[model samples]
Target: MKRPVPRIDLFDVRPDDERAFVFAQDLRIIEARLFSSAEPQTSTTLRPHLSAKADVGALMEALQRDYAPRGVNLLRVAGGWMLCTAPDLAPVLNEQAPEQRKLSRAAVEVLAIIAYHQPVTRAEIEDIRGVSTSKGTLDVLLETGWIRLRGRRRTPGRPVTYGTTPAFLVQFGLDSVQDLPGLDELKGAGLLDGRIPAGFSIPLPSDDPQLHEDEEPVEPEPLDFTLSPLPTADEDEN
Candidate 1:
């Protein structure tokens, strides 16, 4: 008779150890998903890639714990999960300036106004800024993917309205538009004067993508907005 194969019990493993191994595998899957994605990943989007019985929440928590001491961290951003370098490491990494188109001051102001007051018309933006807003400025912002044409206002001209995009939230590392600095925080940051009118206040920003009661959906083939070439660095307005 052939030498009896060495008897081995495959089921002799401890239940806790087996569970731990499964947990570690699931954590790796979650980690890989986060690493491979260019944008933040929501649990719903990540569920299909994991084992049927995997607990995504627990796995994410465990992965977060594992990375707590690392140079990078798993953080929530733009209503999803993303791996970001720890804040403390920013100074060390700031020397390498990434090449990117710089936004003009006008574009920055327009962007801020859109973030604070969404579904606003071009006229409304100009009114709030107390100056004319150039189509070129709006075009620069649109090209940045930070703002979008939300809809058309129901008023006389039925002008197109603007709102912040999810890209804006991600760029700013915010979970929502409401996470933007409030009046108190602005004052603390010296972005506002200490002496302000009692009635002056910041508008509560909303990123809701729905058309408001006074707004209508944009046409399927909306009219193309005419955009002028962006100004060169030296020509950009202060």
Candidate 2:
């Protein structure tokens, strides 16, 4: 009888096939890393486990393409990569999930102001809103992990400034603050009516993650405690 043919393994493949095989394994590792992570993973974090010849960018692109037709998609958010449910499937999933607590209208307005004009003080927020911001509203936002105390304003009293956090970007599916809708886009969405106001313009937000000239780094330990709680006109407003 003729000798049985030997089994073909990935190691026995041609040069191109061998690289492809290695890449497939790398893709598996990437998928696992993404699935197991509670937060988005950056290329810097994912590069270590990959093969020496594997290109993280190329692998990510390939993986993105592979998932394009599936229920999940590879998205770049908060300066990193994550696999998330396809946008079209969100409604169905939302229905299945338990009802989630929603931000109050006042909280929503405060969040929007911070997102657009970050490194802003409570007074500045009140200035923009034309009303005293309630402490409860800020407390609620802080408890949600959507915003953080960035730094202290250089002006007298050195009030603590607030800005949106990375969680904010992840929740909103934005790659960066700059991805926020522009004035025209907002108007087109009917968010901004055709109200006539001369010299009206929306400020372009930044994601510098650095203290501004008018701001100072938040000191740790006892210094942080020295800043008293912000004065609120209302004890509670939801």
Candidate 3:
């Protein structure tokens, strides 16, 4: 359901450099909380006050126009302003954090396609992957809020199309699809193969035997084919 944008105290942004990033991150946390809220309150410090009376437009200008030039990227979504680094610099952080776990090749490709040609259909995805995706695969991404439906495509059947979610960018430390690694970069890094790193398959644990001990055994049906003639109407009735 659509809700009112909580008034954020725009003036709360501290006058500092490194703290800008912290404030930017904190601003998103506040927005996420506000977006998910029902009875939005004004008592919240960061909801929507700015410079003792500056309007939101002026605040955005101050944040996105001026501060962003100094290396911040302010994005307005869901009636809230979020502070983050420009998409241009996202790769630098990812490069620096080499220890961060990489997603499976299949998952990465799925994400990449969604990032590039968003609102794409499952058929299109299968064509791109050259293999049918498990039904649960997309479910996993959706459950993690990495992707979401972007309405249906106006095709023959109007299948629901998929697109990346904001959480996806946050998780990857990216500002947008524009921050995605270039084709040449992926190729140079030998990542085109899209192989998942070793041993990520999580095998399920066995259920408790106690739960099934009293359950009925499923009997395997015996084959009864002996070149029998098709049942006549009389025999069928009998």
Best by lDDT: 2
Model 1 C-alpha lDDT per residue in residues 1-238, reported as the tens digit of each score:
5332222232354456766556566666777888998898988988887777777767766667777899999988888889988888999888895868889888898999999989788999999899999999999899889999999998887899999998998888898999999999999999899788789998999988878999998887656897789989889755
Candidates in order: C-alpha RMSD to true structure: 13.2, 11.5, 17.4
TM-score to true structure, per model: 0.82, 0.84, 0.44
lDDT of candidates 1 onward, in order: 0.84, 0.87, 0.56
- Sort the predicted structures by TM-score, highest score first: 2, 1, 3
- lDDT at 21, model 1: 57
C-alpha-based local distance difference test score of model 2: 0.87
Q: After superposition, how far is residue 1 of candidate 1 from its true place, in Å?
A: 60
**Per-residue C-alpha lDDT of model 2 across residues 1-238, encoded as one tens digit per residue:** 7333222343455656766678777888999999999798998898889998777877777778778999999999999999999999998898788887999999999999999999899999999999999989999999999999999999999899999999999999999999999899999999998993788878898758899999998886465446768767685552
lDDT (Cα, 0-100) at 213 in candidate 1: 97
Residue 238 in candidate 3, Cα distance off native in Å: 41
Residue 124's lDDT in candidate 2:
95
lDDT tens digits, residues 127-238, model 3? 9779987667777678777887766665576566777766666565554556667655666799666575565331222212121322333234578776868999999899
| Clashing residue pairs, backbone N/CA/C < 3 A, model 2 | none
lDDT score for residue 161 of model 1: 95
User: Which stretches of model 1 miss by more than 4 angstroms?
Assistant: 1-16, 220-238
